[model samples]
Target: MEGGGGGGQELSTDNVKGIVLALLSSGFIGASFIIKKKGLRRAAVASGIRAGVGGYSYLLEPLWWVGMITMIVGEVANFVAYAFAPAVLVTPLGALSIIVSAGTFYPE
Candidate 1:
């Protein structure tokens, strides 16, 4: 419905931007979890301590920090997206994160 006279459902640019941001958030946040885990694995191997065992070696890993930063950016993007679009449209998008994160986090 491209008609301008009355009721025509159209996606505003803000909604589109919000959708994009939400998708990016899912991707970044999803990948960050795996990346951080990968970093922790490397740190544990190199430093002789697993993060799960109270080891802080992951803190020294640049890759882990990168994952942290990516997570933060994803969260920020998710927050900002709310300002551009309704929660109804934004909230369900989080489900995408599970799909995006699940496969990668347990990579074979």
Candidate 2:
């Protein structure tokens, strides 16, 4: 059976870039999870802010603001990193953040 194309097989750089962006986004999401968790912990201890654990806005609690900002910045960096590097490589490197977060955040 003939495929649908001049021949039917040509790699698109855009597809690769999209995949890279997706992976990069994933790493940022993981990092965001850690950061937001830590931030919520902070906010809870802060003395003047309230926190709840239901719904979408729960992730944006005042204690979690620092985390939100950090995650935003990290995501921007991840995109830039992915634009220049392969997802396979970038994702592994981003995994390091998990260790870092566990050590720093989980302890508190």
Candidate 3:
């Protein structure tokens, strides 16, 4: 669920395309997160420095920095994926972001 920057009843053609793109983008993003989480865990084990969370924030931890960088990289990767793949294939794949984000935020 991206591009919720505004409220509206109807989306313009461009908006429709953007929503489609964003959905596709999210899938790539979700996969990136999984890869990042594994890498973060490995690094923490190797370096003996674990990430911590507190005070409504994740704090200044290595995993936090890695997550931030992964977000940026994932956005870039999604653009690349869209460039190569058709929107139909990409949209559903990209939607993994919504499910992943929802699970993280509203865990079972």
Best by TM-score: 1
- Model 3 lDDT tens row, 1-108: 776667755545655555566665685566557645655565565656655421223333465566667677768766765665556655666667967754663211
- Mind giving the per-residue lDDT tens digits that candidate 1 earns over 9-104? 788999988888898988889888888888898899899989888999999999899999999998999988888888988888967877877876
lDDT of 2 by residue, 30-66 (tens): 6677768867666555544546643344454664666
Task: Name the runs in model 3 displaced over 4 angstroms.
Answer: 1-28, 31-59, 104-108
Off by over 4 Å in 1: 1-8, 105-108
Better of 1 and 2 by lDDT: 1
Q: Which stretches of candidate 2 lie above 4 Å from their native place?
A: 1-35, 45-63, 105-108
Worst-scoring 10-residue span by lDDT in model 2: 47-56
Looking at model 2, the pairs that clash are none
User: What lDDT does the true structure give each of the candidates?
Assistant: 0.86, 0.62, 0.59
Candidate 2's C-alpha lDDT?
A: 0.62
Candidate 2 residue-wise lDDT at 6:
78
